[model samples]
Target: MDLKKLEEFILEVGAENIPLGMLTITNNSAAGQPVSMDNIRQTAEIYHSFGIPFFLDACRFSENAWFIKIRDPKYANTPVKDIVLEMCSYADGCTMSAKKDAIVNIGGFIAFRDPELKQKIAQNLIVHEGFLTYGGLSGRDLEAIAVGMHEAVDEDYLNYREAHTRYLGQVLTEAGLPVYMPTGGHAVYVDGGKALPHIPHSQFPAVALGNALYLAGGVRTVEIGSLMFEHVDPQTGEPVYAPLELLRFAIPRRVYTRSHLDYIGESAAICMKEAQAIRGLRVKWAPPVLRHFMAQLEEV
Candidate 1:
């Protein structure tokens, strides 16, 4: 996170205008990059100083802890569980999608230090979801989450997972693809704009690159560029585009082998060789909000 930008924005907008402050641990939008421990603590301090509550979107907390262990020398020898605990200590609470770090197929949860807040959330949950005990999940699912949460913090498992992602990033880079530096915890992001310079931002280069990867080896990837972040400039009434066109290869946990990644790298290489022939796409239909989720498009 850009600390300067964040502080400047908060000051410019005025603390009274802000409702809540939340930080994503493994900032998924930025190639799953892990947030530093110092940054989290400082961010929480900033929010608390302004009388704003701070929360964490801690879905990949375990992976993030692992990154800190390997990247920051101060915590090089610290236990993953200890690192995780310290990370959470800086926030008032956290919301999680258990599917990511918890290693569950589905089901998520919210945790807070305040009992009053917990009661309020539970009351709402009872009205919309199920009872306080289960909260719409079966007992078995709850058990899985309980077990998965512990396994997620296992250093042996985390080491393997980090190495696994790095391997793919290395292969992609060696294959002449412009892969993002310092491979992230969960996924490898390629600079689609660099690969498909022929396709402009207006044409959704990231989407075209994703399509090319799919066609090359049946490998699926998500576009994290204009298609995902495009918006209108309210002041000028002009469309705004993302600065970087990126394609995210979000590898599923405990799935696929090195061979699979090799095939993906080869597929990307093929796309690079024939990148000039790739055509850009034009949106045909879209929703008013989050158009990328279900937008219809055709080659332009």
Candidate 2:
């Protein structure tokens, strides 16, 4: 989603000319969803054509691994550990967000076998972050990350989470609410555009939905819109354009039970049923970057 970060990484890798062979992408998948080995192979081949090494953002490898094993029984005998390692081997390096599949408190890691690249990245990591030895992550957090990574691969855990997501999706869809197709992750996405087609991007649909959900059931969700990109002009001090607003309901793994998810679904249904358009908020310019969060709202 954050293409900026990916572009930066690509630039860094390309600068070294490390023969970056392949880049793996998901096929409309979500967190903890399975991906096919054939998909991976095809992606690798695409990159191989360019004679560059390939790397996958294996944050959801656990789900993909399971999917592959189930879909292709021929690989049933192959251990997930081996499959993941082999996939990683196709790339010179890979990075994963520990907070997702790993389910750690909050952390991330990049792995590579190349001694030179590893050393260089490690040096930069030390200066930018903390020492690789410390990396600002406590030992307890590291242990949790390790354990969570293992737990993420458990069939029961993945199944339960997937079922819960599907249940929520079904509830919202049956209620005639706009919902994205259920994928592997624990979250359910309510399409703000569908929910409020009349409301323009500048009106911030996600923020409106979030506020409505709170008023209805005290539930909180985030907007994945371009609100973060909106900026006021320096001289005239006016917004260039309104940003897209999307509400994201993130479900933490093993936290909320089925009943809780049902409650969320119910709340979403209620909010959508009673949804109203948000009137654009007028902005009064201030020096420097405006803290939208601190801006006072009045029903204009």
lDDT of 2: 0.65
Residue 109 lDDT in candidate 2: 82
In candidate 2, stretches whose alpha carbon ends up further than 4 angstroms from where it belongs are 1-36, 51-53, 67-83, 226-246, 277-300
Candidate lDDT (C-alpha), each: 0.91, 0.65
RMSD (CA, Å), candidate 1 to true, equals 1.1
Each prediction's Cα RMSD? Answer: 1.1, 5.8
Give stretches of model 1 more than 4 Å off. Answer: none
For candidate 2, lDDT tens digit of each residue in 166-212? Answer: 78778767766677664445466667766877666666565667777
Q: Write the per-residue lDDT of candidate 1 for residues 80-178, one digit (tens) a residue.
A: 999999999988899999999999999989998889989999999999989888899999999999999999999998999899999999999987889
Q: Model 2 residue 279 lDDT? A: 40
Highest TM-score, which number?
1
